[model samples]
Target: MSESLGDPASAEMNATAPETFRARFETSRGTFVVESNRAWSPNGVDRFYNLVRGGFFNDVRFFRVIAGFMAQFGINGDPVIQGSWRDANIPDDPVLMGNTRGRVSFATAGPNTRSTQLFINFGDNSRLDEMGFSPIGEVIEGMEVVDALYSGYGEGAPNGNGPSQGRIQAEGNAYLEADFPSLDYIERATLVGEN
Candidate 1:
């Protein structure tokens, strides 16, 4: 664990601290809440918990959003933090829950590759279960806000007209705002019970 994003030592110490927690995201679209259960995906939940506590998702854009597919985000606004978390992979969790609509899970390129990126399913995506995507949480409120997020750019670069993950990681929000201005972004993310 590195301290680039925040106090990694403290995050590690709190890794096993909670079995369940709720995160509230205040985004440009609207507000939504995700209720995460560690029992479903311990490592994923822990990582998300720490990231929220560390303010990693603040001002992070929803860079990849497809109408009926999913909406993705979680790259840090700061390029350095994004770079640091690029390879900070967490071990895979068993698929205890399917990737149904509104369910949130860590996005991965492959096994054990989940770092800071995550997506909320827009429709039933049970196929992703076999591919090893485990849902750590689900939207307990404001699913409409998630659904209404801007998807005008469609899929990201190399796939569609949207921003590229590589560029996002390298340039952060500056590149997104310059090129993809309509993209929605999180204004802040905070734990439900925390100040």
Candidate 2:
């Protein structure tokens, strides 16, 4: 097995190496691909490249899927990894692109808080662009699969019926499967050019 992102040994790995890449996600809903341009959001793109190459997104649940809004994920399956990355934030990227439909951006609590969480916009969310949500990539294929992901739980935490981030980081997928059983998940995420 590969080292989990939460493993302290791997946590310190640099994600800043500049590289343009494409990622393919095999999900319970279906498969989709995202092509990232390094220049769009250097730090965000690099972090995502590292995560995808590290197998960090495998078996991760789509914890926050709000219809007509966005679908969010990136909490690792291992609680340890989830905890390790909770504060492993990267610097914010200037909002060079609008959060239009199919665009993917890092999810942040505030400025420079982007860690592992990412969301794919379901519609034109241009408002988020002004709020500093820089898109790292856009879905190049199978966007319908993204749209079809389960959203029955709505937003997360104290606002909606979805699972809590705290619980997810503490208990991992066990909590999600037991509580949000219908949620779609990433079975695996792979770099497009890799074997």
Candidate 3:
């Protein structure tokens, strides 16, 4: 049977992830692997795991690729999917690790606001730990590919010229393809060992 794809509030979306597992992300640039440890952040890991299993990251853009900083993505390109997850907030996972280079953590608006967006640190961003950015995993392979993802767009709108998150959520990839055509995107993402 196919895996059930549901909103975060549903039981299928909340199913527990493995104690340790790897997720392979195939992007426009190349493929990379992130091995997540549930012990570090169970809630965050489970959400990420289910999203991959449910094929949620297909065609998602690396919208905010900050050179020498991090590459952020995970916003669904389908506005319908985006709307379903917009208010599906998950409580903050107590940060158990620092935001070192290659570490992955969910992006948040504030406390308990983490939903789908996440970033991969390109440098030591330990300072984020103090602000509650709990890392669920780190890139275990193809760090160079992660390093090479296009970053010419810089920061998101109002601050810089990159695509605005609100617009991406509202208009989906149509807005991105028209305005920011050079952005690299995830072709697909998958669990490493799932049958």
Candidate 4:
């Protein structure tokens, strides 16, 4: 049978991972976790998709929090941060996936330029896929955690002061807010078995 989002059989097919990873995020405010069981190809065209599914960089921070728009994470600037592995950039995987809601995709500046930055989709963003955004997985649980981030124009925000204006910079730079709620942290992430 063909895979359909509504079918339980299809859901299992969508979770195409050999193992499961649980990302445990520890923020000053509280802890949050994201679970997954999908794998991405390391050297294949779907490499970017795989990294997000592989749980390779679990425990990364939700470095960027924008209220109402999205809460972004997946970059561990701190060397001491657990699961922060030093690795080279992976090739781009733009043509194979999309930026669907609850879907996870790598953040990029240009083509073939993804290091370790990733974000979860709060809503449908089809425009990003054409721009090279690759969806790896969907938020199986705790999406409410993903949606509760404090939204605002972060320090050095390019969009000025706006509700939808929030930015999480590449290369390990976090937002200016010292203490806030609605911000989520990936407490643990692991890859389970694929269908």
Candidate 5:
């Protein structure tokens, strides 16, 4: 692993380094792939490798959706998908980035609870950081597809984890269920600006 994996200065040097990323979401509706832009990735390939090594984002569906507000995902409610690196939460990276529209951030139930769960901001939410929100990346494209998601409630409704109990709550309850996008899959994610 590159020492730059957690270094801030080296992140910029990685700018010229080729980078690529791939994320998959498994929901009650179906599984989908989400390609990410690495040109703007703060830590470049190092961050990408860290995410893959975490293995917490794998097959985890977006579990929360608040139209025009934000869309949260990453946690599968299974113990396997929860917690941070080494079971120790990474320090909050807020202020390093802004919570602008289309920004993807880690979700924390509280201070440093961030682990596998993440959220995409639908609007400017600067106040979020004051509340401990940390955005990791921004969406360079695909805003159109994200906006077209169906906003509905109930198990497997169509929008996201549904309204009644949310994905986290429905994880163990056999009576509850959730919904998510249909046929939504990431085509591919490759680093930009690298030769």
Candidate 6:
């Protein structure tokens, strides 16, 4: 991993991404490929491309996988690196595509909160379109691997038996390793052609 991704606010993330590209993810469960279309969500695609190329998703846990819904992840395992991105939010993109099964979108708390977190829809979640969640890509290979990610811990804090995002941010993987040992994680993720 390079230092470039450690600083999410860097200008490098602002460059527009390719018209279309593929990211291959090798995970604890297996492998999957996501094909991102810049036209779908330019800013989101650019941020994702930079992150994938700079190796930010390595060792990141699939922290929030919900059955029949989506698999969410993308918090950096190192708290220091994660902290650097805390305020690096991006503007929301228009929903150009439906959030159907296999669609990938950034997770947001509200308007324009997309930073590092992303989710892959497991079912038709088109209802989220009105909520401003734009689909930047779709899983083009090994969707089964995504579906196989552990979801035993349901939703995070104040919801179900999952680890708290607050604790994950503060304590890094230590909190997750101690509490959510069975969580699946990305071994490494990289831009397909570059690697």
Model 6 lDDT, full chain set: 0.92
Candidate 5 lDDT, 34-142, residue by residue in tens: 4444454333223443544433344444444667777765443343223223243444544456778877777776765554456778898888867867565666555
TM-scores of the candidates in the order shown: 0.94, 0.94, 0.96, 0.57, 0.56, 0.97
* 20-138: candidate 4 lDDT, tens digit per residue: 45444344335445454344322222333244345434444565554534456655433433123334356765346556666677677677766566677777778887787766555
Write model 2 residue lDDT over 1-195, tens digit each, in one string: 246555533643555635677899999999999999989999899888888888889999999999999999999988877777788888898989999999999999998999899999999999999999999999999999999999999988888889999899999999999988999999999989784
lDDT of each: 0.88, 0.89, 0.91, 0.48, 0.48, 0.92
Instruction: Give per-residue lDDT, candidate 1, residue 25.
Output: 97
What C-alpha RMSD separates each model from the true structure? Answer: 2.2, 1.7, 1.4, 10.4, 7.9, 0.9
Residue 152 lDDT in candidate 2? 93
Candidate 1, residue 103: how far the Cα is off, in Å? 0.2
lDDT of 3 by residue, 87-158 (tens): 888889999999999999999999999999999999999999999999999999999999999999999998
lDDT of 4: 0.48
Query: Pairs clashing in candidate 1?
Result: none
Q: Please, what are the lDDT tens digits per residue for candidate 1 over residues 1-195?
A: 225365444545246638888999999989999999999999888888888877888899998899998999988877887776787788999999999999999999998999899999999999999999999899999999999999999977797888888998899889998999999999999999886
In model 6, which regions exceed 4 Å deviation?
A: none
What is the model-wide C-alpha lDDT for candidate 5? Answer: 0.48
- What digit string (tens of lDDT, one per residue) describes model 6 on residues 1-195? 876777676777556788999999999999999999999999899989988988889999999999999999989999999999877899999999999999999999999899999999999999999999999999999999999999999999978889889888888889889999999999999999776
RMSD of 2: 1.7
Worst lDDT run of 10 residues, candidate 6, spans: 7-16
Q: After superposition, how far is residue 22 of candidate 2 from its true place, in Å?
A: 0.8
Clash pairs, model 2 backbone: 6-81
